[model samples]
Target: RIYVFYGPHGCGKSTFLNNLLTRFEDYANTEEGLRYEVVWRLNIKKLKGTNKSAMSLSAFEKLIQVIDPENEGKHDLEGKDLAFDDKEQEYIEVPCLCHDNPFLVIPKDQRRNVLDELIKNDEFKWKLFTEKQYEWVFKEEVCTICSSIYQSLLERLGSPSEVFSMLYARPYYFNRRIGNGISVFNPGDKPLRRNFILNQMLQSRINALFQDSNVINYLYSSFAKVHNGIYALMDVKSHNVERMVELHNIISEGVHKVENLEERVDCLFFALMNPEDKRNLREFPSFEDRIQYIDIPYVLDVNTEVKIYMDIFGRHIEGSFLPMVLENFARAIICTRLGKKSGAMEEWIKDPKKYQNFCDDDLILLKMEIFSGVVPKWLEDSDVKALDKKMLKKIITESEIYGKEGLSGRDSIKIFDQFYSKYAKEDRLISMPDLCTFFKKLGDQPKKIIPQGFLSSLLRMYDYSILQQVKESLYYYNEEQIGKDIKNYISAVTNEFNSVIRCIFTKEEIYVTEAFLESIENRLLAENADPTRRKEMREEVLKKYTTLTLTQEIMIEGKDISETRLFQSLYDRYVHNLKKRVLEPFVANENFRNAIKDFDTEKFKTHDRRIKRDVTFLMENLSRKFGYTQQGANEVCIYVIDNDLANKFKNA
Candidate 1:
């Protein structure tokens, strides 16, 4: 498309034009006229502009004689074979010397002022008019940039590395010019890799080359050494000049073997000629199509997730000794940006309680990121409401199950599966983009979170997608085995009697209230005569309530028993269930058991180092078992697949 950037001077039209120049290094590197902003890359070695000396045909004719004094209009300059060292006789050197406003070479500061007076259009600065400087493009500034790095590319004579070595090893602007010595130019051997700064300044930019390409633009100020001189033709509309077109085309094509420093002169031909050919050039077959056009999600800009992952993981690794990350959470542990949810601690240091024989609800909440399961009493306090919307939203947004409702069945099922995946696996990053981390935005506020596990049940009952994963893990075991494993999982928690008692029965409100009671208790016992004279405390142990509610959870789902019966059963079997799931197995499994038992098994026994073999085994097994697969299984990044399959996409 034509981008006409015309306006009063200094309004950024030129600045925008410079930006446009940097758009397609990858495209420009191709021998096939890599068109992006350009219709086709062209080599115009004998290119000349119409200027002062070019104002009249005979003036251009005489100037050409200077290049080849022997040639008069009668001699044929067509189909000529001119070597790099050919006498300056083969072509004409037309000087654009117009003394009325002679072109003067001025230093950087004086360039604008000097040109303003001498190079203005005749009507504007009539006192002196040689030739208006055709748009003067400055060369790219010097950089540490190396030339293309594909060394294995069979280049003639000088190498890609050699080209880079010469260019970057010096401090000079870089541009195209007549190359000399030994080298083959054009897209000789390798492709270009983009340069970028570590800072996340760019949200993203499109590559006009190829859509599937992931190229990004990195602003750089470095340039290689350059050379500049103006070429002119007295008149383009003359027969003699028109007849020399073949000579120009020949010169443009003959020097394909030249170093990068020399090859650029070939590139300059089209640039200088762009004004004349811009329209016709764009009409080519290749110019109209795009191999790539970038689309950037705004999420890349916030980068809140990546930062959190780094910080949290750093702290988690530094302080944590006994790590018990679930296998699924292992890969999905990305989305390093934490606090995307809001109000959560920037350093959410809920230390690991593995190998300790008991799991703190807070630790579980930390590992599982299941906000509803367990959290610091302070996290859910009404005071949390005082936090800003982003913070408050982050707090309740942990698990879809415990967050607000009203999601479409598909969405509800999707979120639940993602949470379970991240919760099940450890070290694995959450397969989330920055956009996905949020509770529903209600008006400008986040909705209140219902109790944990509410959404999970609702989705399973409402959306059959709950079957998506269950049928996989339990696919091998019979109902009896599945039931046994389930019971085993539950019973493990009660292996620590006090742990079970403290967990299921401790209401968050009660724990917060106890912090107050515990403080008071210390005060009562502190005074000098407190032992004997303090108000008599109840002469009893801290007994716990026997009855519990399994009603809203089990009974609502109509799982085999009445509300009263289920709670009674939950209370009765709670001892064994907690022992099985939460404590015993955790204390027995090699990965996590040692953390709880406080034993160090030797390295070999604790290792999970079988990479390729296991990955292949897992992929084959999962594919055969689940009927989902992608091309290039081994080569593809599993993070992409995990994120896609989990459907954890949020605002992204």
Candidate 2:
């Protein structure tokens, strides 16, 4: 019967209304008639609007600017031509963000009120009595950027359709929240750590962009997005829109020249949507051609339905407006189509099978974009049910629901259930177990109709997948170096194993130690294999209060001494032992054969310059465990014996 418009600040309620109108014309009998609508007439001169603040009233009149979506780069609205005509149209308000403009100097409040009264003709309220249906207008809530002024503005604009006219036709509000706060990520205690971060931040690669403090600050923002994705430093809030335009240019340039993982993925998405970058690139010679996306006009009547398509659903789905370059693409990755471009303009352009610049590894990333939390409104709840079936099949398979090739229909339901249940409850920490079980407990074959939000949510969750990728990255630098890695890992895990073995278990649990002395060893031994169980650490009688740096040691040995590489090795070793240690006490075993099964210690393979250097380095650590000098080992007394329980009791 009618449309009601509302939502959170800056969420584009007005713009939503405009989009609805544009989509109307695009709809045919099948989608239309099925999608009903109404045509309403406006009795405008009679629209008496109430307001209080002098500045607010001026802002209210500035609503006229919503008629022009592209802000006319003016501080004040001294002369703008807009007059009310009683015309019938079936459309709603186009949601738009707040426009930032100075309020008019209207000190004469009484005169303003009188003028308001004349605009409201009492007889006009009776003209379109579906006036009875005004209350039922479609209303959207939870995301309008400016609720304070919306009410007064809504009244003047009259039901949503007229408001849609004002919004689609204009650029209304622009204001941003700005602040200065230094972010401290991953805090640590020791001086070395503090020194590391402090130094890195001082010479921050991100800071190279600015000389002017104001300009520099205006562009500073950081989001620790899915790990290793390109994080952007964009310009937002600069009064000069040129800053935004320029930033757009730099981002596009960076997209092609990506060298590090940090800049590649992050740069791709951040460059497109983030308004934070005060800069927009209007200068690139091929910018428009490459991106194939254009910001629509602020004014001039936009077809309401079509506008809705663009603002609500179109921009996101049409992510890579420029077609993917098919030749460079892997067949499994893209869905290439060989057809002449078809659109209203019919401008012949190539439409690549897949999206732009995509690769096979990026399939997960593309999927992640669907689930990234910031959802657009056009994708109503039902849309989530209609996901691309083929894509869903691939996604389900890729997620490794059972850590395998693909999921059956039954498997998919379970996976979706678990994923929804956990995320619905807000437990976003999905590890391998959670991932494997994400859809294992579902009971229904639910379908998606309005799937935009869910799709966005999935895509957005790419960060989680990115984090999972770090484990595999140990292979990235040297995939076959697993041989060197296995040895290093075995040793590291052994050291940790020794620490865990001494405290809680019987002597039988720790045979590698000296029967008499190394008896009460480290606590890691004899712990239960249940991952959820707490580890009862042993009494660490052998103190290890020390500091070590493998950087210089790594350099001297002629092995790449990257801290990331070293840490990754340590982490991998720990994980493997943690998985298998309960089943076998191979770590810290006296039986060198048992403990070093995979630890290839052949001098040529094992005792390379790097290994020798590391062994010598570790020898210092081993000596410290025995309270001995670096040159020798000092044996200690063992309190526990590895005999039968009854015999041990008799001896005691």
Candidate 3:
């Protein structure tokens, strides 16, 4: 198979191929060995060729060399690892490129029947005959030289058994260092010149056996070295593009013709190419189907992108930034790679503005989260339910066309280097502000590649998220009291005003008046709710309590009123409103701001005891609940207060 990995430069195409080779080597070394014997890495520019004629071999002269009838051990090193220097001239050996398989020593006509009779495993025999790749074992003849030798030896000896005595098998060694099993060709390497090889002693023995004196030798070329192995071209451009064209016959017909002989090459062919270099193949349209193109686009997965950074830099780099701020930076870089619009995202989310607090208008942020293997909790229930397998598949499939533009892998590393060096400090951890400022100040040339307005949307999402975190960290309401309030409110809403009753769940006495109703209703309903809206909200709670809670959960099921679905809903609203207003008092207080800034320092203790306690609790909880350093917790609090986030989202 001829595979062409096409992508932008610095997109890790070579890294992927190296990893693949490592995996292949591991698999081949396991107990169950691989089917292929060797892998040859080739540089097309260094492959030498010629049109000159070579001397042919006579019957007996080639037979003795092929069969090695003397058992002289001249070719014993064919399978062994060899180490040689240029000074050691005697040890230097030319590779036998057209070496024949030991089993091919048998006459081609009778080989299959002999194998069938010798084999005992019926299933194994069936597989060898039926599998397409293994068909070569029975269907294909040996190299032309070996085939000619076998016939001549059979006729001269006049006995098949005598000719079979010379057949033997040797192990094949795969050494990457010496280019035995694996070889890599670079563009600057000079082409190999043609050479003819022969053994004098073996030729002398063959002449005595057949009494025919005809000197014989065979041609050797670079193509013969890579037969039945992996042949990879690093980059298919420059002189290599012409090499790819020369492979048309071998790739299509599975044969390489050198001089008058045909060498059958069954190798896994691979090439790495840039997207722009794909134009080099325009003159050869026939290569379109012959090559299998796999796109190695930019890293789209956020976790994967971060892993690359961690691999290049150190893993401790995570401690330099706030919890998700580092990932947010990754998201910002990925934003440049994505297209401005996605029809699949639009089909899933009809109104992108509804999630303005969490996602951008184009919903590229939302798509990125999905690509990172997260189904965001902020999505509306309707949209969440709509994300079935079919819709999710469509969304994921749409990502294949993205990551073609924007920042390359190298560009992201360079930008991260500049950003980290500029902002990472011993006094403070990297926060959202630092990230936003760094990208916002990028040169106009780089900024033009980024989708417009994505940075602003990202900042808004980060601000809203941190604001909520601060509210939840500061919120300290009694769980038991909130539960009792919900139960008492549901009981009062179902009954008439000014009525006195003992709360069934809380066991407390309550006066059901307008003031009592409005107290709990104020948290459940919006603060600006008018008379009709307040009435409708109270009635809705009452109807739910009577129909579902009282009938299904409380009475018939013998469940407590506090455990009803009605109680949980009212309880969530009650707690949410409490957390919403939890930051109101401190947002305007100068003392509170000072205490937060002074936190983790000696000056924090000099403030009022109440202020000091609140600041300590906020900082500690921010670190414990979210992954914030003490410095980060303090900085985020200052960020929230300085930006007036409390009033910004107070109505929300």
Candidate 4:
């Protein structure tokens, strides 16, 4: 069968093909991916003689005669480690060809009976070797050369057991370039020939006992080289129509017509072509029918796109000189490729209103995150509850249609290469500005391939990300104080809960309150359900909480029941607002900003504890939180306050 991989240019079809071949080759050589082929010990001299030089002489070898129950052990002779015994024979080993299995050497009429018998054996009884694979192997005929030699050996030896004594089996490895089993053909290659690949020993056997035989040596064609393996056409359309017809026959009929010989080529066929090439091939209905086209489109997932760069450039480019906006650059290029959501997708999504309000950019980004295995942060309980496999499938199908439109990673890489070179030559560090400049030119070009609002959106995101980073640094710097405040709030809530509770079982005062206990239960169970069920659930919760309180005294780390997700979610929201609260007073009040700039320590002392804490917190933690030195952080804080950089992209 011909498997054609189709995609737009720069979608990594070629790279994928090459990598697949490499990985397959590596796996085939391993023990788990083990395959079998037969080898024989031949005697050009006499069978009974102990000729020491026979092993050294390559001319004495004749690879023929397949055997049942062949050994599948690794070849020890592959290494130089030699252990010689007096009883060992010095015979030459020769591997058989025509990609024929050991079972094929049996007479065609006896094959089914023989296969049935072999399958009964413990080694062949396993599910690893399927009946279809056995049938495939059983159907293969040894090459004409091997057949001729086999007949001669049978006539001379007069018994099948004698023939079996000369043969052994080991792992078979496929070589892509040499076309031992796998052949990859590119454009402008010479046509396959029927030239016989005569063995050095067999070349002199023309007038021997097998003189009347039509098969002295096997014919070596490009088609024959990949017999029982794989034949890959790099770009099918690049070749002439005649060459494609040859491939069509192999794909459809599983046979290639050699000179006067319709040889059955048992091989898998693969082809890689762009969308235009695929369209061109569609004109020929017969050829199109035989192909199983697979799409190799550009990746939409942001994380996957980032990973491609990470793998290419390695963990850190130029020893930690990797630009912070490297991911931003990847996202910008991917954004250009995203297509609008399809109408077909609406059928999959039950409530279109849930997603109807989202802008094109927002939808695209959400799809990207979804493709990267991220759930949307804004999803409500109802929206999440409505999701199923069918909905996801439709969403994926919609994304697949859009995948054909995107600007390829290759296009982005070229732009990156140009700017990277500019910075490298000038001995300057790469930055987000360099990437922004590249995208600006791409978006502004006369024949713009990039989307209209791409550059502006990216620049806005970059500015916002920078500001967000600064705020995060501020949050981390004051984390100790924030933790203390959160602890105080928790303590106050606990005190109020303890005061309201009454023990149900002991008829004594209980520490746990009903409302507080219900909150924990609600996280795991339903809300506002049966009273009896709720009471029973509360008992279970009380037991776990009592254990936690006794063991760790309500310390968050020591508690067994999970509360981190809830606590963290609450903490993040609180701190997010706290950051804004801290910023608003400084941003709005010019007098407060001036004090911050002038380092008015005397005036700072006169303020309330909260204001004083905020003032001292910024002064102390800028360097430690962010990646800046003390002087740099101090300067950056003042710059941000003076320019009001936090709200710079607010209008966008």
TM-score to true structure, per model? 0.19, 0.17, 0.74, 0.67
Off by over 4 Å in 3: 30-177, 180-190, 195-229, 258-261, 389-394, 487-517, 538-571
- Which lDDT tens digits does candidate 4 get at residues 222-297? 6766776777877766553346667776777766555545556777778888766756666678776677889987
1-652: candidate 2 lDDT, tens digit per residue = 0012222223333344334433432342233323221111212232322211211222333454445556455434567654433232232222211111111111123334443555565555443223655322222121112232234335555564453333322222111111101111111211121111112222221122111222111111222111112222121223223323333544554321221112211222222222333124344445444443322211111122223334433443222111111111111111111011112111111222132222122232233233232222323334335444654454434332211112222333243344434543221222222332332333333222112232232322322222122112111233335333333332332344434343221222332223312221112232323322212211221111011224333434444322334435444444433333221221233332221222323532443354344334333444443232322211100001111111222211
Please give, for residues 21-53, the per-residue lDDT of candidate 3 as tens digits. 667656644667533321111111111122111
- Model 2, which residues run further than 4 Å from truth? 1-571, 580-652
Off by over 4 Å in 1: 1-24, 27-387, 390-581, 585-652
The global C-alpha lDDT for each of the candidates, from Candidate 1 onward, is: 0.27, 0.27, 0.75, 0.58
By summed lDDT, which 10 consecutive residues of candidate 4 come out lowest? 63-72
Question: Candidate 3 local accuracy as lDDT?
Answer: 0.75
**What local lDDT score does residue 86 receive in model 2, on the 0 to 100 scale?**
26
Checking candidate 3 for backbone clashes, the offending pairs are 39-230, 40-230, 41-183
- Tell me the lDDT of model 4 at 156: 73
Task: Evaluate residue 360 in candidate 1 and report its C-alpha lDDT on the 0 to 100 scale.
Answer: 27
